[model samples]
Target: MDRAQEGGINDVGIGALFGLVDYRFEILAIMEHARHLEEDYGCGPHTVSFPRIEPAEGTPFSQRENIPHPVSDKDFMKIIAIIRIAMPYTGIIISTRERPELRDQLVRYGVSQISAASETNPGGYDEEGDNTKAKPYEKTGSTGAQFTLGDHRSLDEVISMMIDGGYIPSFCTGCYRKGRVGADFMDLAKPGLIKEYCKPNAMFTFREYLEDYASPETKEKGLRLLKELTQTFPKEELKRRVEGNLCKIGEGERDLYF
Candidate 1:
């Protein structure tokens, strides 16, 4: 943490790879690490990734064969919930290491960020320019990745899934852009008032994605979901502003936020 700060890095993510030791002890140690960062450097982790061990290509036979403490789906859910309760403001990032069903459940259990469409190998993002196409959704046995992933869905698919689950896929960075960090961000999040800004930001961003990036099928469903979610916002004034902002985005404007 200190080294990151010294290097002028404002945001740093901290995590302990699960399955090495007792998860209970690890969670407490993670909390203590966060506390230490705050106490000393005035900033704790910006995000945390809870990844379990998975076999990767080229791993030594002996290392790959050795069994470690395994984390079950149920226990993983408990860890996410505990972390959410322990650190209300820190962004919890769940990777694609968990299966789709498990990832879905974790989202509802306090996972805020997820790598729904991740490719571990180089050039995986390029389809035409590079020979390395998007790797198949599977464990990292065929390629060189630190760990294998479970979820293999694309970004569009993930967005559609989020809508189906009644969640607006967000691309907003308002809080961070506005310099909210450390204790300040936590204070707002702890009281549950961050949603006042986050909800509208999500709607606007989703509107933008639907207008520009979404496929015809995804756009149709996404817009319908957006309309439905709009009606659910309690404050008429805020809702009106969100509608206006979404309208602006549709007019080719961008980067609107609360």
Candidate 2:
């Protein structure tokens, strides 16, 4: 981490697999680590990922009963929520190791990022296609994955579900692009001014995806959500800017952001 900082890459993310050790201990460690970074470099973890262990091929430790300390569904949810409340500005991410229903709930609880349509193995993406789609429900077999995934939905499928859940499928990379990193990101985020950038940036990226990649049904739903969200901004000026960006995205502009 220090090496990366020395090399001028200040942004970093950190995590611990929950089932390897007790979740409580892991959470405390995560908090202290973030605090340490902030004290040392004026920046902490940009994101914190909490992936519960899942069964994997050729690994006894990956099995449910064999895991050193297994985290229950209820406990896992609490952990996510705790992390959210403790570090409100840092992005909390949940991976496909979690079940679909749980992932949905995590979004509501505090997960800001979700990894979908993942190909975990080295050649899995190039050779095997999406293991989530190919082996949606399989848990223990060798399907060319590091571990059996719990959420096996495709990107479009996941987007549809997010829309149903009243959450925009965010692909926003505005903060990094806008040079909001390390201490700089915390400045706006701590006081809530980040919303002025986050929401509009999310819409811009969502618009690009809806225009170029979404299925007809998804596009319809996403556009409607976009329209509704556009009206939600407290500032009319920002809302109008969002409205214009949406138009340009529809008119073939790409990579537009705040």
Candidate 3:
């Protein structure tokens, strides 16, 4: 983290593989790490990820057969809940390694960031028909990936689900862009006033995505959902600002924020 900051990186994310050891011990260790960073650098982990072990295709059949310390669904939730309450201001990220149902449940357990779409292989995103594959790393021999992914939805599909789940799918990076970091970031997040800026910024970015990137069907649904969501914000002043900014966005104004 210190090296990254010295190299001009402003944010850092950290995590522990939960199933490798006693999860309770790992959580306390993570907390200690966060405190150490803050004491030394005036900033702590910007995000924390929790990933559990899973079976992969390229692993040895014998080792795969004898899995170690697999985390149960109930224990998973309890761990995340404890982390959430322990670090309310930190962004808790859940990856696509878990099934969709489990991912959905993690959102309610204080997960603020999620990997909706990801490709692990090299050149996975390109249109070229490259079929090159890499073997998973093993201490003794080549295997394959350490784990398999569970969620396979596209980004648009995930956004639609988020909307259905009453979450505003925000693409806002306003906090980091605006220099809110370390203690400053926590102040806004803890008091819940950050939403005053983030909500409107999210609407703008969602609008931009709908205009430029979304498929026709997705655009239609996103716009309709955006309209419905706007009505739920009862604060007149905030609503007015959001309305003005949204109109500007529609008029091709970019990066406008509260």
Q: How does residue 255 of candidate 2 score in lDDT?
A: 89
Candidate models: Cα lDDT each: 0.81, 0.85, 0.77
- Model 1 ranges with Cα > 4 A deviation: 6-8, 61-65, 127-142
C-alpha TM-scores of all predictions: 0.86, 0.92, 0.82
* Tens-digit per-residue lDDT, 1-258, candidate 2: 767876888688989988887788999999999898888888888899998888887788888889999988899889989999999988898999888998988899999999888867654553545453444325545565688878878889999999998898889988888888878888888777898788888889888889988999999999999989888888788778889989999999888887
**Position 19, candidate 3: lDDT:** 67
**Worst ten-residue run, lDDT, model 3?**
128-137
Tens-digit lDDT track of model 1 for 1-258 = 778777877778999888888899999999999988888877678788898877666665314346367777789999999998888778899888789988888899999998767767654667543433656547543555666678888788888888889888998888888876556776676678888888888888889899988989999999998888888878898788878887888899999987
What TM-score number comes out for model 2?
0.92
Q: Ranking under TM-score, best-scoring first?
A: 2, 1, 3
The model with the greater lDDT, 1 or 3, is 1
Task: Predict model 2's lDDT versus the native.
Answer: 0.85
The positional error of residue 47 in candidate 1, measured at the CA in angstroms, is: 1.7
Task: Tell me the spans in candidate 3 whose CA falls farther than 4 Å from its real position.
Answer: 2-9, 61-64, 127-146
User: How many residue pairs collide in each prediction?
Assistant: 0, 0, 2
